[model samples]
Target: MKKKDKFIIIDGNSLAYRAFFALPDSIMTISGIITNSVYGFTNMLLKIINDNKPTMLAVAFDSKKPTFRHKIFKDYKSDREKMPEDLASQFNLIYRVLDVFNIPKYQVEGYEADDLLGTLATQAKDKGIEVLIVTGDKDALQLVSENVKVIFTVKGISDVNIYGPEEVIDKYGIGPNYIADYFGLIGDKIDNIPGISGIGKKSAAKLINEFGFLEQILDRVDEIPAEKIKEKLKQDSEMAILSKNLATIDCNSPIRIDIEKCKLKKFDEKKVYELFEYLEFRKLWEKIKKMNLMEKSLKDENKFQSRTKLIVEEGELINLIEKIKNLKEISIQFLGSNNDCTGIAISIKPDVSFYIHIDSKEKEDRFFNLLKPILINKNIKKIMHNAKYQLKILFKKGIRLQGLIFDSYIASYLLNPHFREHKLSEIIQKYFGYIAFFNIYSNRAITIYCC
Candidate 1:
């Protein structure tokens, strides 16, 4: 199917509520209202938005009632505890977030989100749209089809398993129909489905493969499978039937959702900022600001062109070393492909911000070492963002840099780890809120002259 026809539906309440409890609850407003779930959910939504670049999206929520699956099996999910009052209360904020992002949210009166997802999956398939249903629940696997795929969230909700026919086959060793059958034989303790007494996943799969269907296995019970298997299947005939029914998702669930209605629209940054301000997300609020929610920003004075002049000429080495040693604290920035021997640029800031090129190893080593005394000096401070990588390089060279203060990188991350990559350029932009380096700022400098 064409890309435009693609649709993505998320199990919002399931994942959002999960993210809420996954992180520490220390993130709160000064008033003692918790915002950890809000922040984490927002970050997750932002990442999904950026990655999927979905043309259409919607978040589906589950109803409070026991689903039809549970009616068929009373003990289904009976083990689950009730939702926390704090998390339940936070649902209002998530609802408002949906409004801010301009994405439609849906919650049926009497169905779980999984049933809604299955309903939507069936509808999207009819419309010729490739559907991607994302959730942490593996039970959603029953919805997999040629036109619809299930991407189960794993590894702390960062990655997903894209289950098409092949992936489903590879993983469960059964098709969706057989999947319900497979689970029927094995039973799910969480959902409380009970299979045959002696039957497990392996035996179930083997039997299903041999007979091709659950009814078929029982139809030819005398085809002489193991006596143990035959006796168990005969005795728990009711359980086997009930297990299959419980495992099978109701694609024909009465949840009447209009799939076309889930089409996405541009996010409402203003609304987002308003809620962000209410929750005290100062840094994220500013990030939304720079995204130009107003569409055009005011004219400012910090515009300066970065002219990288590659110096490949010979014999200008001594003069450069002398100039660097005479300066105190250099602001250094490198630009090139290979990080190790990449082209380097260094300059001293405040009045004499002249950038010198370093194309040779001799130059790279010399400039890095020149700041050692300042880096190790308790009275002096050196600043960097994502200092771990850069510091590792320096440490490997036996250049132990201690007493350094102000890592703009970590500061930027502590501000918003979800906004940008932990790169220096991003931190500089976040903290300074402008491209200050081209003129207002410069690169890392290495040492001694009182500039």
Candidate 2:
């Protein structure tokens, strides 16, 4: 069977609102442009692209004008708080970022982003294309099906919960089609949807699971076991129906854009860099640099290739150290276990990579003694991944490692602090488009040139 194309439809307003509140308002640019929402959105967008490798994408935004739901029910979403000024200010900048990436964006004058997502997803599913709806809105759950999945943001941008038909059943105890009915009976105080007065989530799910939908429950209200619950359902029958109408997303919204228009393409790196600079996103700028470097390295593999050697014999170790004694710049990788210094790799130039193993205390002491002069030489630059970890291990061996100029570990942290670890392979793969063949003990030295 042929593979189906993957399309990701995002609810921009829902995610933007969630991101703004999830992050602190203090993430402001140097020019006083608040970027909490923009940063979160950018990260989420990149994460989805990297994780899913979607073939097409579109972000649907809510227009400033009131939606059709407002005309149907004047009090619809009336109780929701207005967007804060700081977050609102970042919307245009976010749009600019999307433009730089060449991603299609859509908004209808009288429809919510959810409706646009539903429409696109429904259309894609019909064409045998898999659809992934990304949002923080629970209303999107109604669109879940065999070909459509909803990725709901659980906490900020890092954690998410994906819902297929089975997940929807597991989470809500009803089929995807019953979500609107469930909300109709239980009510959504957040959206000010007035469901049945006495029904809660459990009651709503039980009724929907037992009788199927809201109309069925209402039609047989008299058969309900609880008299009080039945009385409330009878009294609020009209409101329940109205709530369902409001909660139901219009899957056939008149969205006219062709799916081909949403194909993913290379972004304008220069423009993206300029935007990052203008926003003063220093950490994000580093990431952009890495991405650009990776692309370049992939396009020209030979340009980043270098020679390397691992030394285990004592004679070979001394000779290599002697060869690069006068080198002005060098990179080092100290390999150790249980705080015991075990081996080291040194790369003085792109063509020269050396590694030495310390098999015993005598060998370890002899290696450090021979290399200590170069390490202390202020004129010579030393580079390594996580110099502190190396320094700590050397400290335990009664040696002081110094003259360090670049530490890729701290650099990686500053670039993306959310990552759990900045391993050598991860850094190399991220910046070079392929995993490094050399392990932590072997390739730690050459990472100095990754930036």
Per-residue lDDT over 1-451 for candidate 2, one digit per residue giving the tens place of the 0 to 100 score: 7667999999998778877988998887645688899988887888888789888999999978999999989999999888888888999988987887778899989999999999999888998889999998899999999999999998877789999999999998999999999999988988999888878888888888788789999998888998988999988899999999999999888896477789877775556656765775656656655543222323333343445565777788778877777778888887766456766778878666765756688888778887777776777788889887787777776667667899889998988675667887657656555434433444453232322
Off by over 4 Å in 1: 1-3, 255-260, 282-451
Positional deviation of residue 209's Cα in model 1 after best superposition, in angstroms: 1.4
TM-score of each: 0.64, 0.67
lDDT of each residue in 1-451, candidate 1, tens digit only: 5455668889987677767777678887767788777777776776676676676788888887777776667787778778888787778888888777767777776678877788878877887878889888777887888888887877555666788888888887787657877877788876767777677777888888889778788788878459988888888877888888887766776655565567666555445645775776766655555543332232231332333232333345345555555544555443433356344344445434333355467877775565455456544345444456666666665677664565666776676654435655434444443323333223533221111
Error of 1 at 18 (Å): 2.5
Instruction: Provide the global lDDT of candidate 2 against the true structure.
Output: 0.80
Choose the strongest candidate by TM-score. 2
RMSD to the hidden true structure, all candidates: 10.1, 7.3
Indicate the worst ten consecutive residues by lDDT in candidate 2. Answer: 292-301
